[model samples]
Target: MTDLLHDARVSRGQFLRMMGGLAAAAFATACSTRPQTSTPSGGGQATTELKFIGVSDQKAPMDQLVAAYQKAKPSVRITASYAPTDQVQTSVRTQLGAGNAPDLHVVYPGSGSAMSMSQIAEAGLLADLSAQAWTRSIPEGFKPAFQLDGKTYIHSAGSSVIGAVYNKKAFEQAGVEAPPTTWSEFLSVCDRLKKAGLVPIALGAQTPWVTQLITYALVPSTVYAKDPTFDDKQLAGQTSFAQSGWREAMEMYLELQKRGFFNDNPNGTTFEQQTSMVATGKAAMAVQVSAVLPDFRKAASSPDDLSMFPLPGAGDAASVWIPAGVVVGLGAAAKGANVEEAKAFIDFLGKQENINAWAKAIAAIPLVQDASSTIDPAVESFLPFTKDRAVPFMDQRWPNAEVQPVHFAVIQELLAGESTIDEALRKMDEAYQK
Candidate 1:
């Protein structure tokens, strides 16, 4: 969901528009710890201090991870920092420029697009920890996010998938024996659920990222049909969000809305409320990530009742798998004799013990090459399908700076009936051309 987090009183719209801009500003504003007057890498075996930042929305597991990490590296002091999800990108960037960037930091990558943060890596603000043996353990297929152009720059601790989440009871109430697997079947299920007096698709229009998942579910099939490396291709500007299956995917979205599938005032709702709609049986299903499972569990009477399916598609091959994980890299601010020590902390994280702790902490699938790590059972059923062909969502990797906001606004407009599907695509085409 573009790494955005909910902040008190701030609407999702205001939050995301500020993401690219604020991400740069936040780090500068993040109180620099014990001011360092020099840019030279600090030296010494003296326990090098490392500042860390992670998202607060994910709990339970994170606290345990912090404890485990501290236990492993007694010599290094980590001042863990956390903020609303949307603020992280800005915060990290600010710290880097301020020379207070943590020795190791968390990054969420867009499938192919490289932005300001990657430039930091190019500038040597980040240390390359890939030479460590632990990284060799991260499995294949999941390495793209960390391995930029063959030379590994970042390391992924775990991985997750994007798909549709539904209430088992609601499906039964709608007389659906199982979740649909194809577009026609899905539409039929939506129709039955709607006829049964339930909102067919629970949408949090207020949190536009939630609405974007529908396209995420669809784009993979569209891209994979012509090329498996479609995501990488788009990242290179070989194709565009508006030119390919994206149009059909977006059309499917409008079709669902026009069919009266969404809950009332979807745009006014938040992701928390959208999950609640399915959890409480107010609606039939929602398009969400596997990471969303634990949250649904907390929101519902029985978390076990919530299940996932890769979004139904145009794929001749299989359903899609999209990455929803973090990228950890050594900091440019890391100087001194402890530079290697900071490198050691990152290496330590890749170890089976720390990697397992991080994955299980957040209920994440260890993307690292560890044979022992596993994902939640609900998400496990679909893992086999992810093995072959799948496309990352078009917007997740869209090259244009304006794509995210333009897509967000277009979806809202579609919901408001202010724009037709054709007009929406036309606008998208204009943005991509820019």
Candidate 2:
């Protein structure tokens, strides 16, 4: 596990097998167990209060599961709050550094960012979750995302894909009958939407993390579809973003904006505004992770108004691919006073029923499925590509934390016309080598 963590690599075969298992697994029913609690010394019912800070994508699932946990374990109380990704990453990391972290906080899978599971675990800030029963069930290819040094530190329900979340009514309004299957067709669809007076794509570039989705959606088809070993090559210093399909992906991203397909003043728009635009049919679609489908649904007049389709990044349908990776999750703080209680709560979440609940709320596939597990219909179109064409989110295999933020910043700069693809990739390469 330590070697795997250090390597941060999962081969294409392994990844495919993991996806196969997720699609085929049929398991026996698993039961839920409540965390143990002790009575107060004064003889009154003892209560333990736990604090959790997570990102917006987690709110729906956490709200549902938290209520269920409270109902089952009245002695333990959890107060969870959520904020946008950029804010949570800054504030929660600060809390962790100051030794005043919440009992549990948001953790991204793999070692991509400052608050990723491996990064926090390496700093001795995350508690070991290896003892939990659910840790035993993590797919072999996904272990690197949840574990470091052979110990589980994070709990994510399942993986999600990055794609175009479109409003069906808006598509109809533009005279588009179906999702496009090729890059040229996609452009035609966008052109029609624009002609119909709808924003073809709702890009909220003002939000740092949202800036990367367009590139992420394109890279698998532009880069990995041609060379599946791209990550390995990049890790070995055999190639770079400036020297590969990443340039094409970046150019394709700008081509959309160059044609005025995006909402007006994208750099000034917020993620909330982007969601509202698509949900309300003011915009036809947004390139986003499937995990946030619930947020889009919540903001819409009818959840069924929206659905997802793989963004075709190549001119040929056969060459198109998608990005699928572990969703962001939470971890318990190692130094918290309620460490055991926090662990117990995580343990409770480990139950198959709770995993189903969490995954269902966010439209994710359950990490380990049983008869009860359900995959959202919106993502069904992506299943055919997941086993072969999909790649893990690029950051998951990045050698260090610096590269992702650099990627984010460069995208923003490129969007603002302050940088070129050459300069942007060069900046990312420098960060990668750091």
Candidate 3:
């Protein structure tokens, strides 16, 4: 039967034999049709096939790269599974409960995601992938976000900046001859743009992550820079999501929202759709990250139409490094059948060439030290600001998970007129109380 499965003529027939016991109609046979005795690609004997599970947001490049890998090794079969970023853990948890899960998926180290994986890791449901060469590429400051007791669980090729991207031309048009380097000047510029018949700022609260971007911009201004001992205080609970200057920040966010700056129905817009608002000049700027710039570049009539400036709260460039955000999460089911092969796939991914390709494809900065290799040219103009002073995105570094979500909820409530600034602050404080 194994030999027959390897035979081209009997491939379909063998699939039926293997899957018939699991289901009826054999139509699902095609789903499991790969030969069990297949040789590994790029080797003498195939080891195992890796099954990947994660968000489909980056699927295009993954597909292209995987196809190239397959061309180089016809024997290995690499299966990629995609789900919404929010759903990846839930899917894995469900499958774990059902005694079935992908060979490799996604997980984060703290709070919402890592908590779920921590149970499995404690139960030994995950495999140790720390030995992979890719682990070496992660920067020193960010290692904790992906690690559990010194073992790493996730790998992202690069990271994105969590700051503001403004239009150079918009400032010129609004009688603001120079980009403001102070928060007061920044708000004044927004008022100018709004008065000039342009939406002062663009936000996509409908997608939720947009709300996080707003918080990301505010984190540098409201927390990290203002508090002389911010990180220490935050870790000690002396400073919290609610106690900081966040109320002022939220008030300011609401003020902008009330002034009709963001898209009228931010909740109705997708990230891509909201990105268009900035790309086409519907809004003078967007509270976004480098992750969205690829979409912006693709949609822009002139890629030059978009450029970035760090949010003004840092007092100066030297003090403002905390606004960079990174996507950190673990790989999938450790005990799944594809562990060895999946590790192989990840190893191939960490190679500088592939990592560089992935970073440039998304217009993000490199996770590895050697960034000069392939930074996207259109976005490269923004790199100098990131150069000596780089910081992990605020959300990733935060110990308490609720802070980010509470931020989005409070902002939405503020926008809906459901809560006053005082109430929002109290709600925020209560949220941090947990």
Candidate 4:
């Protein structure tokens, strides 16, 4: 898996093409029918049941697409459920190990998490999706996220950025007219928001995955913006989290907490509470991925009040970068009885219209776009930076699954004042080596 991951290096040009969208690839619009047992409903019509489990961010699009699929193929009925990242990672992975996983389940891009494509594919638990037409359209730079050993294993609609999802009303209330462009200005804005009696940042550190976003949002500027080859150097054992810009990023993360810029008792807050705080204008913003913009909008009285901006992680606006990576996606279980049926659903998701719908639902940049693709306006501010100023999510390039969970744990400890930056980075470095 390590050799395969190393082989998946993406050049700058290829990365640009990916963000810009690849040429339209032809896909099969005809749905295939398969033999199934007859059901009592619909006058003894055939019925095939497939179960899918995914993270909460996937629910909005999945609900819409699943309904479309069922309408197209009445014989197949999909039952889908959503859960938080930590829960899906733990329970679904256990199900995979036990060989009774759902027909389709959430799979993180690249290889840093237990449910990542490489890790799951390495275990031979993910069905090969290389034959799908959509796989042919995947941009070369993004192959690492969608494929392992040159075989596509997951189906994702597009990429998303991690930024500050802020409430316009809250910002107005704080007398802040615009989003900050530099680190110092960001701090000043936070101070103003805090003084105005609003939580400058709503952080849900108790939810493990939520703990990593602030650092992920900051590291691109502190690390990659200075040395684009930092991941390579770390993989070569020439550098580490402790010795690189990771230290600076960690310090910055802690600095936000130290300034009381985050909501009180962040370590006890859940992602739901954090989303509510920002959506309803109780807080100015939350550092989060663009993929969850729908959730924030759903919780708000007026969705238009929510918009996103790149979280400035550097003193210089030009040096600041953002984390843009493939959104969490689903894969068919290789060992499942309904593997073919599940793969069909993934194939349905690959169609252009379906991809557009999914991307629009999550406010992501479509993996492959055409005239029909509509990017969410909230993320328009981050587009100029996508060409050269963005890096894939840090975990996507990690050598093992251990590093990410360790990252989540250390951040929680730091937020709770139970750990120091040095200690946190040390633990992360140790996990990376493992």
Candidate 4, residue 128: how far the Cα is off, in Å: 1.3
Residue 74, model 2: Cα distance from true site in angstroms: 3.4
Candidate 2's TM-score: 0.85
lDDT over C-alpha atoms for residue 380 of model 3? 52
Which of 1 and 4 is the better model by TM-score?
Answer: 4
Q: Return the number of clashes found in candidate 2.
A: 0
Model 3 regions lying over 4 Å from their true place: 1-47, 71-73, 87-89, 108-124, 168-172, 175-178, 228-232, 258-260, 265-270, 314-321, 328-332, 377-390, 398-403, 425-434
lDDT of 1 by residue, 158-270 (tens): 66677778888999987899767677888899999999999988889898667667776776665565577766676677776666777887788878887889887888999
List the candidates' TM-scores in order. Answer: 0.80, 0.85, 0.80, 0.86
* lDDT for predicted candidate 4 compared with the true structure: 0.91
lDDT of 4 at 105: 93
Candidates by TM-score, descending order: 4, 2, 1, 3
Residue 210, candidate 4: alpha-carbon lDDT: 91
Clashing pairs in 2: none
419 Cα displacement, candidate 1 (Å): 2.4
